[model samples]
Target: MNQIDTGLVKRLIGEQFPEWAHLEVKPVKFSGHDNRTFHLGDKMSVRLPSDAAYAPQVEKENKWLPILSKELSLPISTPIAKGNPSEAYPWPWSINKWIEGETVTKQNVRDLSKFAAHLGSFLVELQSIDASKGPIAGAHNFYRGGLISVYDEEARDAIENNKDVFDETVLKHLWDLALQSTWRRKPVWIHGDVAPGNLLVKDGKLCAVIDFGILGVGDPACDAAMSWTFFDKSSRKIFKEVLQIDEETWNRARGWVLWKALITYDANKISNKIVAEESYRVIQVIVNDYGR
Candidate 1:
């Protein structure tokens, strides 16, 4: 894979978009996991997929974001121009109008419950969009809205490997409970990756949403996974009230959270203490919730 840095971005611009090549190119402070983002002058930003796996997102965002933005009240990353593959980069990239805000964090948010309400409303509006032509969940999204059971093997493996560290019996019980229910209604659009890194905060509120690499129409349960890791009990309640999703769907969402936490802990158990501990904490959150 080619290095996704400012120098490469400058070259891509100078080659493909010479009209704006004179503007300086610099790296954004918090570029996300799927795409490497850089500042293109002061008003626009350049975003390139870090791997072929994310290449399809360029087209998806170009097609849907503008449509979604018009109906959505908050700001979204809408593409201005798309750059084709060049000698330096293998996949397509995008230049987008910059959205000004800070990445969301619990510390920066003024009121967790209020922020949750605002976020919940945004999600409700997103789901309300017409999905008659939207992409369905599959490989491009790592099956984010497909089925949590697709990850059953991975989660069970993690449980087996970490028996000494975690209560395997408790985890298995929760896993069974999670898989017992599944989505049985009409599908809706989902922001496949709803983590904090994809959310933007301004004035201590969720002001904008970026990074739509996993946007698609599918089971909405995956979008609710954050309820466990990102929100407190009260705030989670507020968010749940807005979605009005069924209890069975919420169960599958718990399975979604559990799968990610399990693999994450298994992978980093020996390499990074902080990440390993945090993953364990997320798992414990699910376990405690299940006991209720």
Candidate 2:
């Protein structure tokens, strides 16, 4: 994939949003995999999908962020302008109100349990919104917020191929438990990709949530994956208690975490040291939680 650099962004801005064309365009230090995000100015951001697969999110975020932002307590990325495709930029892009906060990380958070509660409260508020006309989980989101079974075969393949790297027996057991039952309740709104990068923190507290590209309505269990991905046992307990999640849903959440960690570990172990290490750490968290 060709990288979208600062030069191309300047051209696109100059061509379309000429009003803000004079503003300096700089690449954010930590951009995401799906999109190339740049600081449009001091107050807004310009996000362009890296490929065709991620292009659809421009419409999704632009159309739905306004509707979802009003009912929720936390601030989310609201689109200010939509950019059309041009010779310089092949796909649709967006100009969003730049959210102010640092990305959440273990070192930055002062209290894990308290932070978990804050996140839990946000999820509760988000889910309570009426999802009658919301989009159902599908390929649009890579099946996030949908059935965990969607990745069953791929997860098994990772396990089978990596028997020498990790504990295959325990991995199989966890996968089986995830497939034991499915979400039976009505679908609710989910952030889909609730990782540290998507969460914003200020003064050691969660302030805003971003990247609604995969936002959709579906089983809430997918959101719970953060328990294993980001939280410790103590904080996980606080999160689950605050959200009032049941045992079945909790188990499914573990499955969601396991599937992602397993695949991520397999894919990046040799190529990306940072991602591989993080994925391995999450895998350990899942195994430890399963044993407890």
> In angstroms, how far off is 217's CA in candidate 1?
0.8
User: What tens digits encode model 2's per-residue C-alpha lDDT throughout 1-292?
Assistant: 3369989899989999899999999999789999999998899999999989999999999989999999989899999999999888789999999999999999999899999999999999999999889889998998888888989999999999889988999999888988898778788999998889999999999999999898888888888878988888899999999999988888788888888888998899899989989889988888888788
lDDT on C-alpha atoms for all candidate structures: 0.89, 0.90
**1-292 per-residue lDDT for model 1 (tens digits):** 5688888998899999999999999999998888999999899999999888999999999999999999999999989999999889989999999999999988999999998899889999999999878998899889987877888899899999999988989888778877897666677889998889989998899999889889998898888877998998889888889888788887788888988999999999899989989898999888887777
Error of 1 at 51 (Å): 1.1
RMSD of every candidate to native, in Å, equals 1.1, 1.3
Q: Candidate 1: misplaced stretches above 4 Å?
A: none
Candidate 1: the clashing residue pairs are none
User: lDDT of model 2 at residue 175?
Assistant: 89
Clashes of each: 0, 0
